[model samples]
Target: MSQPSQRPEFPVHLLSSPAMIEACRERDFARIFTLARRAGMHNSLIARLCDMTASRVGEVISGTRQLRDMAVIERVSDGLRIPGHMLGLARRDWESASADPTAPTVDIAPAASGLVPTLPGADLDSILAVAAGPKLSPSTVRALHSSIEDYWRRDDEHGGEVLRPAVVGQLRYVVDLIKETGEGEYRRNLYGVAAELARLTGWTYFDARQYSQARTYFTEALHLAKAVDDRPFMANVLACMSLQATYEERPADAVALSTAAQDCARRQGATPRVMSMLSMREAFAHASMSNRSAAHSALAEAHTCFERISDQDPDPAWVSYFDETKLIVDTGIARGRLGEAEAAEPLVEEALRREPRGNHRGRAFHSFWLARIQLQRGNLDQACDTAASSLELASVVESERVSGHLREFHQQLAPFRKEPAAVAFETQLRATLR
Candidate 1:
């Protein structure tokens, strides 16, 4: 019989740090090697873990080498126990798809409510038990979280058009589990997971431009999160609502929602990344209101929060996507909202240059903002090129939100309809989107 393959494990703290996240997103071998070395992994161990020679590992750490081959990257991911999606790869074999009772506990604050949660008896339990599988065990809850992460990856790459049903269905099942499971951590965590699924469901609806439905689901998510007192996720749901408010031209509501989110985040011990993310939403709200000083002040605070991030701060998986590149792009988007094209363009461009290869939806969204800034600056040719690039990226990602941005750009092009650059882009947009 073949021996079990050796799988080295790195500390979760090492894998989830912001620097490690950015390095993995950019596929910066040098930075990855350096981070591992700093985390106390010796050169030879790093070599053994990454399936590279000690010399190669040293060269990478010293910035004398780079890893570009996909096969080599996969080896590094498996060896270092890096989650595949961080590298833009598919979920690895190590990421189990099935739920077993022995899986690690799903992390959530235990419910303090003395009363346990249980359904008010219905025959539906017998009917759904087969599909629901074993009564919501720790392993099952962990699997649900893992599936949520996969759904996030899918939305990141391809948007949420098709994932909505699966998300909503799972949410229904989890809601049922909450009703059946009598109290304790299992039921509490189930509420939390249900909240996560509901939030993702709202996000999909928002992505598809179904604003009314999105609002309904977001509200549901907030209520569920409140049930378990999951403050961070509650704040996250509020931030989502705040962003949606900005889209709906409700700057006052946006500001209120973002402020509420920031307050919630501050009430409890939250990671710098979480605070930084909430601060950006506050900045966005201010930018929408054209409050330049306030927006910039918020942006500066966000940067300060980001700078305070350290290895000891264990950020939740949901906030992992808000890495340095995301912060820069979000900052640029806020500037764009404030009509500061001169300041926004370069920041967005730099972020795009560092963005990961597989984040098609994010690239599309960021490119749309960059295109808008260029148009605002009267750089017609550059704007058209940027918008065209955005269109190409959005073409692969199923997002009406992106399409809406492109449409907004096209509407702004009306005065320049006869301009060759504008004409070319308009033609391409119509041809591609149609």
Candidate 2:
């Protein structure tokens, strides 16, 4: 329904006409009805809206009848959605119900079942179309979520470069499922599922070191998570973005992002494991900035969070990879970033021994750190051997990020290129690059 301020179909322009305004000011229904009829509203509809007979409205339009009753006038004001001052009456009840244009509108819509996911400033037809899709069964939704965990498992053993297409394909299909799940409890659940998949898509790109593409997906994941009010997942995406920033040598951005992630995790009562992971990110950010004391404090906080972990905690599937071994290795990575390889090397070595052989990609990643630490400790021969072994472990993986670490380690070998160990490692590195 158009407002009184609008045009011909709504008749606001007619009210603005000098002749019509004069008729309204004098309470002349005969002339007012004549103006209304000329603007396309018929006598029959006007009669029904104004609670009068068709003959009565026709007589008024024909200047043969007059309206003097206040109740009839009020009905005319309301039925046409007119503001009351235009009709020489007090403001009506419906006019008072209009939304304030100055108020900020969030994109979120309240769920009759669960929140209806919407893009910002979405048009009416698209929102209405949300209710038009197929109603999915519980089993189908379960399978879609299950596929997400399966992708994570595969992404652990193999690098994400080869698996990115499949992961993105799954993400698109989940979004399609979200669209199909119109007015059910499954709608919110599907958005939650899509949120995690979007986060994983970002993770795959992050592993490939495609930072811009990675951030785009990370933002999408955050938007999806926010749509369902999934605070834990929102924190997860922020943490991943923080890690990417750390890689890009943007410590201030990394610190800001990780701090935000920590805030979300703690506020949401996320499990101890989640808190631990977020703390680790903060430590990494601090280490990158060479804030050694703050880095150690964050690491201590991470250890405390780890100590609080309980079997009863409702940890999400995404945090399943952040076990004690991973925590230890992450601590080493953070320590090494602050030039503490003497302290970092043992923790990484222990994690390597404890971690499973099936986690070749993770082990390969940690192995590069081990080689870097060995070089920092001036054990060039051991560094060369460790670097070569890391390459062999990662041979089946396609991670650019892991290769990035190897390259960084290789640069430190420039001063030692004439050494037999360096010559041998260079030969091995060439074969691996090939």
Candidate 3:
């Protein structure tokens, strides 16, 4: 692909209104066709853009082809004039149906479940209709990007539920925009964001014990990272995949993925922060595989990496959380897993103190790790107390990994089966398990 043009600047914040959506949805096909012609897109080029045969495009426009293929439907949506977001929704619905025809299809309800104003359903439809029909305007592209960034920043926590259908809807819209615009740099930036969202989705599904769904999301994320040629981001995907594997008790597989991630980071000259994060992941895999020596070695490397980080380009998105305090917490978890209660507790406690205020998620995870240490030290009461607090935080985040950590804690408490607290915690944890 040629270098992308300096994109026309538009105020991102103004794009969230319903009016634009409605305008795009009501876009005219003749106008869209004219726009395409003006852009010098021949029938063959349009066919390629839609991933269809040239004859098929002609047949669809001429009302000969039924456009049974949802892919083609999206292409037509693209060929006509639909807003990118609406086209995305339509395509997602179509794809989901194709995957499982029996699955229930939900209507497009684009409420601003995020920080941005929600576009009306009609407006959203019109915008997508126009985007699909004609070449998109620079303004529309900027709007989609803004909406996605808003979605990225949204935080909806409801007693363990993150009702984020609206955010997902916007992300799909951004994905469609990326595909249609063929803007490599923009697409690359978006892919990183997409991978994080996909990982978050996978983690949520994993918490629900929907292993199949979680794995699917993770796999798709890996594909997206590859598309953007983001090796470190891909490593993050692999590391998260290893976490899933570890939870599934597939220690060997987890170890392999962890190793692969570490190697990829090294080969790519990943930042110290990124490499440290990967090293911590490797340590977890080693602990899972019962290789205490390897786990300790990985932990040491992670610490060394933390010390070596220097001025460089920004860290990869996924590894942003791997600071000194977090690394210490992770190392403590690794030690606890290796049955070093005495060694792990102090480190964990110190790490806990360093955890930044207001990070409820991190605090919850730290509590879980503390619970693990308590359990290993044979302090069932303390462990149960910590577990309860962890559960309270886990309840807010909709994270499967958090739930899995709690599940492991619950399993450890089983030896105290006759104890009331142990029984109660186990029951509560099991109820949430898939």
Candidate 4:
């Protein structure tokens, strides 16, 4: 066979800086492609550099595909002359080789570091200056709150992977404002807003499975909430922590936190909707602990609380997401966890039917639970079909939670591996995961 000529390697000195890695980790493909092009690299060169197909490179650049796999990220670091640590990966061999021996090695840590890095257009000094300035106008505070509301809605439609960085930046800014402001109603309001923002940021981190980072943010949120004596917000944060514990399989912690949330909410006269959410968390914790009776009681309480929620009743913006649909989905999930597949099936199906098309993550989540129920019922073909649908939805969302559920669903299909439907589903799942 004739030998093919190797393409010339780009200058190692031209490699991207740490910022490029941050951009890549944030899924900012446009910035990466722009930088590569600015460096005189074409799609062909990028593909060659990353060891990807030319069309795949195009897809990545166009935002049709995200570079998530570690191997692909490492290849991109080498190809783009970027540092692996920027993408939250271990230091690549090329990075070490290209560095000066006398320079200290930077430990690659999770992107969710202790300090929130300065955003592109904002710096610590400038933000602190703004915070230290005379009282912020009500209009300015409202605008900031409105922006956070918009981000929350966007997060519902598009998963947290794309919004995490922005939320973190906003959170730090709000925290600065709260710290610099003097005691007043405005300061108290800012504290509340900061607490909510911290909770939202923590949620995004939790979705990404960055547990340590999530816990840090959640604890900050709780402290901020407590500082302003906002019991409702405090209860909400505790419930959020409970959800994290439930997901982490720390049932005892989940139960304790959820109970504390319920007590706080009750004392503060929180809305029925808020109480319902706390009850749901309690149910989930009980289910996790395999306490069927306690789980059922909590679920019943959740249902009662939800039923008391009137359409005209006032609801906190944060708790508005917990509608009947959410209640059903959560109840189904609790049942599914308790191995009550027969009872969980219809609830999950209804939740899926009512779920908005734009809520890709929710659809995938509910579908996975439905499929899990089907699998438990020994309906292999149905389970495979349902799981395949979930996998398709999962592929579109940038959510670690959805991806984890898909992975669990895949594992549950192992007993049916000999079946044709299972085989086909596995094939599609592997391709989707890739």
> Which candidate ranks first by lDDT, i.e. highest?
1
CA lDDT, every model vs. true structure? 0.81, 0.77, 0.63, 0.76
TM-score, one value per model = 0.70, 0.69, 0.63, 0.72
- Model 2, 230-249: lDDT tens digits are 89889999999999998887
Please provide, for model 1 over 1-434, each residue's C-alpha lDDT reduced to its tens digit, 9 standing for 90 to 100.
99997555666777767898899989897888778778778889988877789998988888887665455777887788776657754344464423212222222223345232321111122222355365656789899999999999999899986776567667767775676687688978988888888889889877876565577678878888888888998999999999999988899999999999989978878899999999999999999999999999999999999999998898988899899998999999999999989989999999999998799999999999999999999999999999999999999998878988898899899999999999999999989876
Which 10 residues in a row give candidate 1 its minimum summed lDDT? 118-127
Please give the distance, in angstroms, between residue 170's alpha carbon in candidate 2 and its true position after superposition.
1.8
Candidate 2: give the clashing pairs: none
Residue pairs in candidate 4 whose N, alpha carbon or C atoms collide under 3 angstroms? 15-81, 16-81
- The candidate maximizing TM-score is 4
Query: Lowest summed lDDT over 10 consecutive residues: which window, candidate 3?
Result: 114-123
Task: Give the number of colliding residue pairs in candidate 3.
Answer: 29
Candidate 4 residue-wise lDDT at 68: 52
Better of 2 and 3 by TM-score: 2
Candidates 1 and 4, the one with greater TM-score? 4
lDDT of 4 by residue, 1-434 (tens): 98998554434443336655456667576668766776677888888778888888788778787665434565676776565445553345555533533222532222232232221111112222344454577986887788878877777677876776566656666655555566788877887787888788778767776565567678878877887678888999999889889888799999999999999988878889999999999999999999999999999999999989887767788898898899999999999999999999999999998989988888887898899999998998999899999898888877777787777787777777888998999899889875
State the TM-score for model 4.
0.72
* lDDT of model 3, residue 333: 85
How many clashes in each candidate?
Answer: 1, 0, 29, 2
**Candidate 1, 336: how far from true, in Å?**
1.6
